[model samples]
Target: MSFLPPWVGLLLALLLFGALAAWVLRRGLARQAANLAQVVTGEDVQAQAHRRIQQQHLADLDRALTEGRLNANQHAAARDELMRQVLLDQAQAGTALQRGGDGVTGPVRWGWIVLLLGALSGLSYLQLGAQQTWWPVPLSQRVQISATSPEQLAEQTRVWQQATQNRPDDAEAWLTLARLQAAQNAHAQAEQALARVLALSPEPDLWIERAQMKALSAGGVYTGEPWQWIENVLREQPRHLNALVLAGSAAWSEKRHAAAQSYWQRALGLVPADSEAAQGLQQALAQAQAASPAAELAQGVAAPPSAAAPGTALAGDARPVIQGEVRLSPELQKHIVTGATLFVYALAEEGSRRPVAIWRSTPTSWPVRFALSDSMGMGAPPVLSSLAQVRLVARISQTGSAQKQAGDLQVELPGVKTGVQGVVLDITGR
Candidate 1:
């Protein structure tokens, strides 16, 4: 059934109740009137019977007087007595009519009864009928389900849609819909649903959930409101596990290695060391440490020495270097943001994934010049001067993170030798 507005339903109820009360009052008054009419008719019938008897007695007295059976005084006295008795009967009938009329037709008696009934009904409604039981609640808002199949999930989604539309105040329903949308990878819709849920009850965990969805919707970049939400959660609950993890991830994405490490370390301490969450956290920390040159310096770890390659000298004075100019292709120039972080590094062609030498800068112009040397080595052996063959790579990170994320422009030149000068690296594509 279509739902009516609360005021409309209330008005309809009042109208129906009034109609019922008026019907009852009218029936009661008609019944009382009928009874009064019966009483008046019975009094009239008794008066007519008395008059007939008196007339018959007077006729018998007149016959007796005319036949000399009784004297004039006797007849006159009997006649007067009969007349007095008739007058008394008439008076009694008039009193009976007056009493019956007053009892049945009085407005005060019926009016008081109607008022009492109305008052009782109103009190009952206030005491018992004013709860949500009488209110029209959407069925979808009250039901809970676990949907395992695609069809069931669709059905569940429709049900929740109806629930949210019909009962906007139901926070739980909105939250359930948000989770369902997130599970389906509909991040935009999920974010919208989470917004409603947050407006209703802004909890830390819910804030984290919303931030995650918003970041996912924006291609895993948390540079806007998503970042703000994560910060809010951390501010409210510093030790919140999910918030800490997400904050660490955001910092890591933005190349804030120290902050990421700090957040993850605090979060790691909160979980069981042998748990899967701890294992994941350990892996992330290891990756962050590997990527961050400052992290290596902070640890004060040195790489083991290795034999130098042909034509490459280990002497600090004759250090092998590769100097290059990084340029964006014409087609990809539009993707580059001003002040974006540019990473120019040399990696060994064969073995380790770590960079032999790395250069980081925020470039404001195209055709940015970059030079990599052993002096910029990430505190490790197999530095730029020792590599026989190296791969030159240049990437621009719009988010300023060293990690390669989606939409970051990059280019790689394999089989490049150290001491190569004026090498051209083009960030031709994403």
Candidate 2:
């Protein structure tokens, strides 16, 4: 091999590269053929939108919203958007059809060529990228097996279960098992472990963990159930930072935006501004503000010496996803965030203090415009009409000293014409 000239080596290398490229392209085409069936069955909203006019069709909706045909949330949702293309097509039927009939010219050919180039670029990346191994997992099984695979997790879980089984009376083991189960997404098992651990004693971390689980996807993000758990812990230990963050995220996930804001804001105060948890909390706060400028805060109180406080109340953010009337105007939209952390819930009964019904905010919190527009008729919803007189306070709790005024909201977002419309609202910002 060393005897070959540099030009010969280059030639051989280019040949192999060409062959490898052809081989990779063939493999990609095969994958595309296999995925054709799935692609056919999937929704193509983007393609559909591309075919129609977005701006014109949304005009009526925009006008209606401005003229008070819909509320803020409703206006934000922009109803009849599904028919925008239809409306645009009908409006310009003759002209568009005539132009399309006169097509097949130089520009048309150039357009297809441009499209082809884009497709080729994507194909080239897909062909060449197969060899790039950014992940530690083997390429073949990467899709099927996650870095944190369930089987790998179950193995550790078994050891945790065994520890609890062998030492049934050990609170610490029970606590450890509860944490493991939650990590494993074994929610039922985690709850059981937490119950046993709670029977032993009030472990702040365990309660925080329990609250964290509730804030997680399983508890239906923002269900406020985590808040209840954290509330209990906060009742005994006001400065529990985990409880604070969990309480903030849980409250936010549960659609209690103001409560979430207050808890997280207070948690930031107690937490060092530069800490990981606090930074996360700040992001959550910023996201909340973006979705809606919401508020709360309370003084830090050290728990009693005998108390089982972890001394650090740290909880991850469950950034509230807000959905309701557009309390803030379009001018406010600038100040309002593209980031969302909103969740909206209806009372089990009209004016019912208990929030049996809930909407959750998570990493994927969507704007509560369209989805909840029709959910108003859903199970035990609040009958909110325009000009409903009500005053609400957002309470941020620490060790159970709740009702510390962290935030407030009026039933009506004064002066704005839109009324509240339900959606899985995201109150996002930070």
Q: lDDT tens digits, residues 193-289, model 2?
A: 7778768765566666665544443434434566577788888888877777667655544445567677778878897778765666666666444
List, residue by residue over 248-277, the lDDT tens digit for candidate 1: 777765656677778888888999999967
Show where candidate 2 strays beyond 4 Å: 1-149, 214-218, 221-225, 293-430
Winning model by TM-score: 1
Worst 10 residues of 2 by lDDT: 371-380
Candidate 1: C-alpha lDDT: 0.72
